[model samples]
Structure formats: C-alpha cells, structure tokens
Target: MPDTSSYLNSLPAIFSEDPFLGQFLLAFEQVLTGLDAAKDEPKQGLEQTIANLSKLFDPSAIDTLFTDDEKTLKAFLQWLSGWTALSLRADWDTGQQQRFLAEIVPLYQRRGTKENLAQLLKIYTGLLPIIEEAPDRPFQIGVNSTVSSTISADTAQIGGGTPHRFRITVTMKSSSTDELARQRQIIQAIVDLQKPAHTYYELPILIRTDTMQIGSRSTVGVNTLLGSIPTA
Candidate 1:
C-alpha cells in the first residue's frame, strides 16, 4: 500500500515505451481469449465422435446384433452377406436362416450321420422325423430260417441301382391350406439336402387330429392319422 500508485505507473511505462513488446502482449492475450472460447466446442465434438466409435466397436453390442431374434437376425444376415461366400437359399425366411446359422456348426460336426439328418429335419419342421432303413437282408425268407439262397426280390434296387433305402416321416397338426403347402415346401427342401447321395429316400407328411369325440358320452383324446403326402 505504500508504493501501489508508483508500481502501477511504472508497469504501464514498461510496455508503452516498447512498441514491439506491447503488440506481442496484445496478440498473446487475444490468442488466450480465443482459445478459451473455442476449446469447449471442439472437445465436445471429439468426445461425441469417440462415444459413437466405442459403440460401433463394442464386443457386447456385436454379439447382441447376431442374436436369434428375427429383426436382428435379418440385419445380421444382410451384414454377413457382404463377407460370407456361402449361398443362402432364396426361399428361406429370416427365422430359418437364423436357425441355419446357429445350427450349422453342430450339423457339420455330425455330418453324414443319421443324427445330422434328423437334427436338420427337426430344426426345419419342429418335428422329430421317423427315420426308417430298408431291410438289411432283403433275401432272407424268415427270421428263424438259416437258408442263404438269394431271392429275386433281393435283386430289386433303389436309386442308381443302390439297394440302400431310407424313409422319413414328418407328422403335423392339420392347419390352413396355405400353411400346409408352405410346410410341405420346407420339408421338401430339408429332405433334399439331408438324404444320402445316389440312395432312394421317401418323405411322408402325415397329418394328425388333435382331438376327436367317439360318441355322445365318450371322448377319445388321441392323435388320429389324417392323411399322408409321399415324396420320393
């Protein structure tokens, strides 16, 4: 307080006497003010961009994107189509394609086995297929017979003269005409891929009744056979 006025007067004279130093101080002060005003906007924009990039590269978000839900599955498939070389069937819907992607690994693990075929049928139709193989010894006359003579019926062969034959039966509840037709197409496509090469196979679609009344006093709560569509 003793020399406050003298010190303040001396400070102004120090800068006013030097023109270059005065201009430099003025420019430096303006630069600092401008930096203070502009700093927040660029920082906010950079933070927003970093947040968006984090979400795009998040592992959990990527896993959720490929989950089994229909909408997500569709989006995943569309994205996968860019990188995957496998050809997807045009007739398969988003649900079927999702299932195919989910089960493809397991199916390949057990490929060429009956379990693989059954699994594929179950996945596509929601029904466990009844797989039947033809008689191992078509020439055998009877179960107790020891005769080994070959019968002419044994000569009969299936596809491409191969003796092996298989039959797959799919049971379904009766439904609308369009639904049944759609199911038939799905079943046919699955069977076509699951069947063995050069071997004859039959796919029979059996419709069953949900419930039936036997009489006025009795109700038979059994699934009755409706009809069958045989495919060879």
Candidate 2:
C-alpha cells in the first residue's frame, strides 16, 4: 500500500496552484480566534446585554420580547449589511455577551456593505472561544470542471470578439462542521472557482451541494446555490 503519510504531506504541494484556499484557512483561523476573545470576559448583567443585542441586531426574532418602538430590526439589518464597523455596549459578563452575539451571527443575511463587514469582525471576536476546543484538521476538497463545446466559436462571437460562452460546472465536497461552516465553505469555494479572471476565458463554474446518509441504505440530495451567473 502507498504510504498514507506521504500522500498527506503532498496535499499542500498539490494544492499550491489554488492559493486562495490558503486565504480561506487564514480567515477561518481568525474566526476561531474571535470566539476565544469573547469567552475571557466575566459575567454581570448578562441578561440585559443579551436583551440589548436582541433589540439591535436580531429584532425580527426578538421583537416579541419588546414593544414595537423598541424593535430595531430594520435598522440593525441595514447597519450590518452596510460597510461600516458596528459597536455595541455590554453590561453583562463576558461569556453571556459572547453567547448572545454568537447566536445572532446569522444577522449577516440582512447586512449589505461596510456595516456588514463590521458585523463580521464582531462575530469573529465572539466565535473565538468555541474554536479553541475544536481540533483543526487538514481540510479536504475536490473540484470538477465541464464545458460545452457544441456552440461554434464563430457563430457565438460578439462584435467580432470572443464567443459568447459555453457552460462550466464546479463540484466540491467538504466535511461538515456546524451549519454555518458548511454554508460558508460552499459559498467561498464557489466564488473562488468562478472569479471573472478564471471565467472570462473559461466558462463559469456552478457550485453543487449534496447530502449523504449513513447506516443501512444511504441517501443524498444535491442542490445548487440560488442565482445563476450570466454567460458571456
């Protein structure tokens, strides 16, 4: 049998062509570090701190806890989705505030630009503790590409330029962690695979997700991210 150690050692070299994967690993490390910072603080007035954050970022779900005027749902979403950094006050112990912030990390859906960027930094801070307990392993990944060549280059050309396009497929696999990890990995991989530099000469890669079942008979359901890239 081939030496497993050698194969494992070779993964980094084999993956060198895709340097962006390294960036992802670094980003994930940052996320883990953030979680650690959130856990070191003490707890005092934990409940109130949670309540304040609930009103600010997760108002849609926390709205029932307070009156209408107290709901900052729309504004919070906008703030997170925008491109600015966001700061909030905490009256409770550090752990409690961290937990509450972790729970509301899903508010990223509502963020748009820089505000959303700020929200991400806050989340990274809060998620640091949870990562400390987990072991980091070599992440496994797979890639596939397909192209349609039936379209004639001459017929598909635009304004005497390159042909319009064909189709490209990018299939990937990653071990599941939490739901957030799974979703984030998939999105990042798709973006990396389909960047315009890669796609201008090549067809766009479509990311596909799949599920697997274990035990006696296995089951699986595969799906694609919602929106489609325009072919050019």
Candidate 3:
C-alpha cells in the first residue's frame, strides 16, 4: 500500500508481461486496503488502541495525538495520574491536568507540609488555600470547646490541632450554591488524596461577599488575599 501498487510489479522478468497476473495483483491490493480499514478501523480505533497499550511514559511523543483524539488525551491523563498517585478531579481540563502532572511529582518531597498542601489546593481550585499546620488551639475541655449532643466526629475541626491534625481554609467571593458545593467537593478530594495517610485536617469554605462580609463563614485570617484586612 506504500505506493498504492502491488509488490508483484517487481515480479520475474519472465512473468512481468503477463496481463492477467498484473490485473490480479492490482485487484488483490484493493481488497487488502479495504480489509485494513474494516478490520482494525481507522484513526479512532488506532488512537485509543495506542493509548491503552502504551503506559504513557513518553509524554512528548503522545502529545502529538492529543488534538486528534479526546479519548486518547483522557486515557493518557488518567494513566499519568495513576502513575504519580495523584487523584485529579474529574472537571479539570487538558491544561490543568498536564500542569498538575508536571508539578505534583516535585511536591512529593514536601508532602504533608503546609506549603505542599496549599499548592496542591491552588492547582485545582485556582485559589491559595490557608493551611494551618498547627492551629493556635487544640480541642480543649470546657474552655473553647462547644457542648453539643449532636457534634459529628467527621465534622471539620476548626481552631484546633492535635496529633497529626491540622486545619485548611479557602476563602472565595460569594457564588451560587452549586458552585460552592462543587468547589468544596474538589477541595475535599484533593486534601484527602494529598494529605498524610495518618493525618486529619479541617476543610472550611469561607465565602466573602463584595462588601467583605462573611457568608456561611466563621473567622477571617490575617492573610486573606481577596479584600482589605479587617481592623478592630
């Protein structure tokens, strides 16, 4: 198929002038071409098949086909994510996924630290998350602790740090409930995947209105990036 001609064209000089043989070879070549396209299919099957078989170890080479096939891009992204042990969010697009793959590996050395966690959160949410490695106060009895019969243990632990425990706060402008819920889900997933296995952290979403008022939020830290610092 290379030149759209049959290899029999190079036949022995004795048979080269055979008209019937020439016609047969040309007809057979056409049959093979149709079979190639029908059996294995075309670009679609070829792209996905290559992606599935290859481990995506060569990003530079595979990037060539990214624009050609969406399934190939997604499969490669997932393959790289599993390889790096990073549980990327489902909503992230091509650029975000690639950037995370590049950055997350270097972050492994700084895993479980405030900088590491904060950067990972930023990568997904586009906001610099506040990571309190050691909260100013731990869960205390009768002093700052709230007395409640319905306090769930899984609820975030705010204003507190205990053994292998910390708190994370991400402040954003007021948005739709659906948007907030989606952001919270993505943040939780990122924290759960990136945090130390034995460690626990509180994840609080602080919504700041345009006038710098709190919306379903508690305390505002001194390092807020969205608005002016609050003064007493």
lDDT of 1 by residue, 131-183 (tens): 76654543333532333222222333222233666766666667788978887
Looking at candidate 3, what is the lDDT of residue 93?
75
Answer with 1 or 3, whichever has the higher TM-score.
3
Superior by TM-score: candidate 2 or candidate 3: 3
* Arranged by TM-score, best first: 3, 1, 2
- lDDT tens digits, residues 110-208, model 3? 987778888888887888676765444445656546533222332234554346777777776679999999889888887887788998777777765
Which sections of candidate 1 miss by over 4 Å?
1-73, 78-100, 139-162, 210-232
Model number with the top lDDT? 3
Model 2: residues >4 Å from true position, as ranges? 1-51, 59-62, 65-67, 70-72, 83-197, 201-232
Candidates in order have lDDT scores of 0.52, 0.34, 0.64
Candidate 3 pairs with clashing backbones: none
Residue 129, candidate 2: alpha-carbon lDDT: 11
Write model 2 residue lDDT over 1-232, tens digit each, in one string: 1112222234657664565655445433333322223333332234445556645544344444334643354344345434333333333333333344544455546443333433443343322110011112222223212122332211222223233322222232333447445545443443343333323322222232333223211212222233432322
* Clash counts for the predictions, in order: 0, 27, 0
Q: How high a TM-score does candidate 3 get? A: 0.56
**Poorly placed runs, candidate 3 (over 4 Å):** 1-55, 58-61, 65-67, 135-161, 212-232
lDDT of 1 at 6: 23
